[model samples]
Target: MRKLIPLLLLVVHHFASAQTKDERVKIDSILSVYTGRSVDGKGLLQEAITLSQQSDDYLLGQLYFKLAEEHLATGAYDSAGKYYPLSLTPLEIAGDSTLLGEAYIGMGYVLYLKGDYTQSLNYNLKAEKIFRAAKANKLLGRALKRMAGVFIAMKDYGTSEKYLSEALTIAEEEFDTINIVRTLNTLSVIYDETGDFKKVDPILKRAIALAEAIHCIRCMAISYSQWGISLHFRGQYKEAIGKYRKEYELNKLEGLTFDQYFVYQNIAEAYFELQNLTLALAYSDSAMFLAKTENAPQFIHDSYKIQYKIYKAQNNLGKALAALEMKSQYVDTLFSQEKARMQEDMKVAYETEKKEQLITLLEKENTIKVLEAEQSKQLRLYLIVVVVLLVLAAGVLFSRYRLKQRTAKLLDAKNIDLQNLNQVKDRLFAIISHDLKSPLSSFHTVTSTLNQYYGQISQADIKKYLEKLEVASKSLEDQMKNLLEWSLHQISERKLSPEVFDLKEMAETLKSFFQLSLEVKRQNMYLEIEGSIPLETDREYVQTILRNLISNAIKFTPPEGTIWLRAKTAGAEIVIEIEDTGIGIASEDFSKLFTLEADKKSIGNSPEKGTGLGLVLVKEMIEKMGGTISLASELNKGTTFTLKMTGKQQKQAA
Candidate 1:
């Protein structure tokens, strides 16, 4: 039994080692799934981190390294920063210099995302030394490329180009298609920024071809994004939008959230440049939505800025102000983030300095004083930033106040114009009423006198009364002509001139004449002239019909309702329709409408009394003009009057 015990221990120890190896394999499998872009790296890494913490394994460093990279790829800089150092701890403990160097590269990327170019450069330099020590040429090239990106972001074009040129050489020698294409895209961007557009397209083209040849979606997305940027810089906004759309579609299909966010941001800018405010705002919202999820403060800031611009372009000042406020919030957040990062770095420096000074008793006393000075400096800087943001916010609010004041003044001017129009309408109506009443009253008196004295008088007296009636009738006719001329300028003094006229123009004229009436009722009028309308009847008759139809529409229509004057050409006939969203005629009133019966009277919505003779007159006139008129109405709904007239109708009558 004692001899078998050693065998059992040996077996158990072997199984434990095998189990650890299997766990490591599982971790690598999970990482492979994430790196292959099959699933979200951040989620899978979180699970891996949990499992790694539960077990002591040699793969822990690699897991932490991959987790940090996932965070970096998602633009979670702070999280990446934390994870990168954690990764370095396990790698250093395991004596894996290769992974430790990779962790440094990840940290460099985090710092780059945080906008600390100098610190990122320092980290990249350290990574380069580690890679060179391990004789990893490809990795060394990667570090160089990263340094170039930092320089590009810093606007040090010469230094960026120098680094990129070296990286490209290494990438070509190593047959690294990804890095080769990426470096080309980056160089294109630098050239584009330098306004060397002529040099930009060729470089981008090469990158695109290589990326396509390699079937690398990420490379293609990067090249397409840079191409879009170059086109955008050249003022080809629509073309840029097309390129950006390709990038967006590719990134979406690949589930690359960061790439999609960048594409959306670029698309927003392109649309904004094209003066397409709606599309710009839509893309900006998408960018903001993605940026929020990724914790990408810079992209979030950019999204708000684009939204603000779009709102301003649309003349939506209130919304623009709101967007501006949001932009300011993000700006403040980014500033705080940068400030906090700087403070963290300084604290690290202070701690390192304190440790070094403690080794030398002479420098230890001054270390506390130095820390106090740094802390005081940071406090003053925070106060200054707060005050500056407050002042900026005050400026934005004051601009909003000024905009409101201008809007109020503009509204006041519009009101004055409306009041003047109303006054003109009143005066015109007064003149029309007086002219009509005088002629009407004279005709009535003459007829009444003749009727009463006919039996008592002789034939000569009757003839004299008849002559007086004739003069009164002529006078009434002249006054009616004047009124018609004043109301309808289309009416000629000699005779009714019927000719083909633009139906839209006639409708427009009618709309203008009834503009005041429409305004008074708070109603809207629309003209829907489908095509050319050539009427065969007299223009005066058409005008009179329309005037009566429009006046009745206004009187019957309630406040905030609509009236439509529509005309369309139907083969040999021109069909005109006047529709009103108003209180409609009753079923019984339909029969009485065209008849001169005692019941043919209606009080409109405004209590406007009418003899209902308009429709009767219209029907008679339509028949005389060789045309037809029809009416459709519903109770409390609306009314539609349609007229079918043709040039052939007049020819047939002739």
Candidate 2:
């Protein structure tokens, strides 16, 4: 036993040494999973640098570029900008055009993060140059699309539209359905914000279909969510609630608490709109509770407003007044926090500026001393005043010549800038011209097909065609959403709709729509409805939650997989479960799947070619609805998702 103890101790020491190495591996694995977010990329790069010496060859320049990206994502502009140039130097030495393009993109992202919109465009253009030169049209299109987002953020909507349109064309030519969905969503948002409601509906509907077709549940869910919200804005509350309920159920199953939140929140509003005070009050409480729990200011604001109105309507004067008081308190808290952050930023800026000014003063003084000493030396040689004057005249001529040369160089650079601007303008025009044709063509085809085959086409054929059209239309709708979001983010013209409608039916209807596909895959997709679960929420928002989950199940499943969905009540909460016999999540990826704040994004498994922001949107929208969402999965086994929300459905279940 004594001899074994010594051996065990030695083993422990060796294991400890290897444990550090194991930790480094873990960090690398985490970063690889979170490739969607720029921040995760940077953290991974730093860890790599720390673990390996400078002499170690582990794609050092690539690491630096990723570091630049991470900094850019978190709004660290100066640091990103500095590192980008350094990274570019190494890439130039390597002469890898792909890497060079990546560096340019990094620089562009940093400039955008820094609020240097005009300069950011220049950097993106530089990236486009490299990508185009390499004949990487897909990458070039992506660059252009990113540039559009920047333009939208800068409130250059017209320009954004042009760029997105061009990008969409390229995506279509490449058969990139993911990019198609992306562009369509952006365009839908743009149209919505501009009050082009007539244009938004078809776009959103089509986007939902595409997401469904690709088995990208999150994308579909988002489209449904927007569809419901858009319907609510149009005063289609009944329809909106239906969508919200569906989203609520879907999100709950996925353990996407944020999305579940939105479904409940909106369900409450829909009930209120319909003058169902009891349901309305219940939903409002749920929404507020979720908002508070999630620490979401905007959703919280919405919850309070609904409560205030509910109290006032009930003629509870004391409660109504109290609600208003709470409103003020909430607003003040948000303002105070913003004010404090700004103050701190300003203080740091002032200190840095002061130090810089002092350094400049000292440098100028030292220069003056050098000039004085040189002057004394010249004075000692004053015996030749003629030589001194000649020397001065020559010095002045040389300085003048240099100034002329600098001016000419500046003019040359300006001309190049102007040429680049012209090229961008021309590209924008070309994109708009081509893009305008596609949707018009699609609409024309849809109308013509419907009209021409109204009597000749069989019911089954009509359904199939509609399904395809739905997918196509979603592509357009998605573009509009992206466009609008981009523009809104640019100008910060924020608005939150507090409307309600049932979302559950829409979700059920969607399942039926894809019945054929589900059957083809031999997956038994069943919904267990406990009751007439009505919710007051944006139907579109809720739809997004459901669609994402369902589609996600289908995507991950192999042939003959089984998917089960059920909704019931537990106390004050309504719970929905989605169990699937498909490729289940590993224990390690579980947290990454549900933690909305994580850098993780959709990878090869995600068909939508997304930036991985949709889940975050789903999570956020669900929370806004006042619900909770969760997920359980196992490797090669299957995944089960659960969603819980506070709403009138609880009473029905009881």
Candidate 3:
């Protein structure tokens, strides 16, 4: 035994020396990657993990922890979760509290992404406790920051801000530039969400400077992005674009494809707000391309939405419809993904419950065995009955809890539907009462005036009265048509039946239909057609759209004002424009023009009244035909309604 002890000591010493040497080499390699001296971070970490398996538990735990952190940084949450737990056992065996806490922190982040806020908080709190005891200020700050993130997700912004403030203080004290920048960004987000815009800018500015000082490209990019968002929210679009461009440059420099995609979207939005549609379209296309390359459905959907807005702004109705279709496709994909995730969560919960129930049964069986040996038969029987009763009670309570939760969800959805229906009902009634009644009363009054003064009135006066009657009747007719079409649209009863139609013929029809109204208003109507333009769309919808637009032009234009109906063929689409020299719309009202929310009425140059439904109906019909409409106007100058739709001739050409 004494001879064996000496031999074992020699073996132990050799193993210890080898472990120390391997650990040193592995750690150095990891540090090289982390410090940017090497580019193969993931590869090196994985190799380190493989090599450290035969080393001491402490070294192995550290390698596993580093790999998990690498996964976390890259957003591979499931892999990070797996490795984080793997790290914990070895770290516990080695009694390394610091690395164990780090594993807990990483696990907390994974749980947070999985929407397990309670578990995430528990893990973070455990990490915080360990770090506090160890006086690891840097690690403690990270744990606190993670806890703040959980509170942020829970929407406890006040509490999140408090935690973030403590984290920032610790980071500052330790001169941890990375943590300082991160905490500042998180703090700025809280302030931004709480509508304290005043504080966001300064914090983000400081964060950006610190990140720049540290030469942290990613950190600087994040700060710039946040600063751009702050400016965007404050309506400083030009400055926002500038900041987003800076972010784009930094992300591009770092080859951060995903980050560049988001930066492109931000720049597009800022340009869109500034009315720079060309640049907006360019940036949006870039974002869409990146989104497609990444195959990220959510990013694709968002990019399509941005493109839709840009196309709508440019009056490219065909492209806008295509963008909307793409957006809708991605929306459906996202919904399915969410549903699958929810089902997965449910499956996980069911498995957990089954395991728990099995554990309870085993525990009860052991308790019964003990009781049978140590107690009387009657006491053992009583314990068995009590345990069974408790199990039944728990089952019943769980069933009730699930039922209540389902009931609440159903009630909330139904309530939302009811509220939406009510809003539609109210708006419908307002349109009918105000718009329909005004024109009908005017028609009635004009006819009665003519009947009562027929004999007393002169021929010229009678002619003038007839013109007034004609105008009133026409206005009433258009209003009734719009109201009926809009009602059909509301109930989703409208369907498109596309047929080939001549654009010139449609223009002539509209001109004839609005001839009397235009003459009454003394507006010169011009028809400009480029060759033979054939549009493939629902004829009635096209006619209705044109009629309403021409009617608006006549109504808003002054006496002797000019109205032009222009149609031209552009590749596979026909572009139509209804231009009028009239009192133009204000830019502020442009957003509300095509929506049902445009309730405020505007009187035209002839003091003609409008229900604001004409443009709304026009817009809906345009979209129904897979087309787009856009408006350009300068107050008191003129307004142009531009429409674009696919042309049948192009299909023939192809």
Local accuracy of candidate 2 as per-residue lDDT tens digits, 1-654: 233333423322332345446655765665567574543565556566444321212244566677767766765565566557646644664567888887888788777865778878898998898988898978888898889879778767788889889999999899887777877888776675566889887887777777778877777666667777766766789999887876776666557787777777778878887888888999889888888998877678778877877876776645754775566456556655544544443454345335534543543354444445567764343324323333433543454345346434644664565466445345333433553356557667877898987999899988877876765565455433432232222222223343455445765797897687687678778778865777654555556667667766775788898888787767867687778888676677665654323544343343333223344455655665577787878777888888777654211100
List, residue by residue over 270-376, the lDDT tens digit for candidate 1: 88888888888888888899899989888887788778668767867557657765765675576567656645534543453354233323222333344455677
Instruction: List the candidate 2 regions with Cα displacement exceeding 4 Å.
Output: 1-44, 51-61, 64-120, 150-158, 266-280, 309-317, 324-654
Candidate order by TM-score, decreasing, is 3, 1, 2
In order of lDDT, best first, we have 3, 1, 2
**TM-score, one value per model:** 0.43, 0.42, 0.49
Q: Relative to the true structure, how large is the alpha-carbon lDDT of every model?
A: 0.70, 0.64, 0.77
Question: Model 3 reaches what TM-score against the true structure?
Answer: 0.49
Off by over 4 Å in 3: 1-64, 252-258, 293-297, 312-317, 328-654
lDDT of 1: 0.70
Tens-digit per-residue lDDT, 1-654, candidate 3: 233333433332443545557677866676666742235666687666655543555676777688778767866565566567656755775678988998999899999997889999999999999999999999999999999999988989999989999999999999999999999999988887778998998899899999989899999999999999988877899999889989989988999977788888988989998999999889988998988898889999889887876776675655765776677567667656655654453454355346545644654565555556655865555465545535543853475357346534744664565566556556766787777787678778878988897889899988887777777777776776676567556645456766787879888877887787777667799999987777676787888888888888888888999999998877887889999999888888788778766554643344777777878888887776678999999889999999998764111100
Task: Give lDDT: candidate 3, residue 271.
Answer: 91
**Candidate 2: worst-modelled 10 consecutive residues by lDDT:** 485-494
